[model samples]
Target: MKRILGLSLLAVLTLASCKKNEAAETSTATTTTEQKDPFADDRVVKQSDLVSEAKNHAETTLALSEPDFNFGKIKKGDVVEHVYEVTNTGKNPLIISAVKPGCGCTAPDYTKDPIMPGQKGQITLKFDSTNFDGIVYKSAEVYANVAQVPIEIRFSADIQP
Candidate 1:
């Protein structure tokens, strides 16, 4: 009976030791796999190449009359509006894809049609200062088929309580 008990304990110890070795091997394998580069795909494009492509495709230019506007000392809950004139200075027609406001409190309106070369357009921005106080600054990004794809227009105000 004593011999049988000793043999059973040896078998349990061997199985436990085998499991520990298997766990250690798995951890080492995981570490090696993580150390390998994950982005091994062959279709990665360089940023410089993309920039060059953009430069080649950019055939139009967008000119803004006023890039910034300042509204002095306005009461809270006031809505201010301003218009910015945009012109196509290049030989090709200027196509404005989107006019996006930086925040939800600002609204922007613009013509959806393309602005021909030597033609003009307007972007109207309305800022709502409802629940806001002190100095506030906001911006709108204009996406167009110009040399500079995204043009930033900024507006600021001093809100009084």
Candidate 2:
């Protein structure tokens, strides 16, 4: 009878100890989860640093001498090009970062430097008409540090066989 009581007591104590260890482990997991990002409250750019960049853009202005072009009539597989002038008309310098062509058949090149106030820059677009027929039109978007975020330029051509 005494042996049975002693066994029961030992089992209860072991179970209690196991439960206490599990509770400790749960608390540790919770603490680690809450502290995952200790510096989450630090400074950050929700969208971009462009918020400050906009100030410089606001102070400058840019203009395209010609926003549209016509390649007239051309034979199929002909490669043609046009130069569009960009002028800085504001108090600050104008910077052209990138010029993105609208399609694979069109290639674009532009001034890779900053244009000072009252100065000029050029963007040349070369078009390939290998797979095009009839009347075809293409466009490009210019990214710059001017008042306008992206300036659009377009060109059209009549391709003949």
Q: What TM-score fits each model? A: 0.63, 0.64
RMSD of each: 17.4, 20.1
Clashes of each: 0, 0
Best by lDDT: 2
> Model 1, residue 128: displacement in angstroms?
0.5
Q: For model 2, which pairs clash?
A: none
Task: Give the whole-model CA lDDT for all candidates, comma-separated.
Answer: 0.74, 0.75
Model 1, residue 147: distance off in Å is 1.5
Candidate 2 lDDT for residue 139: 87
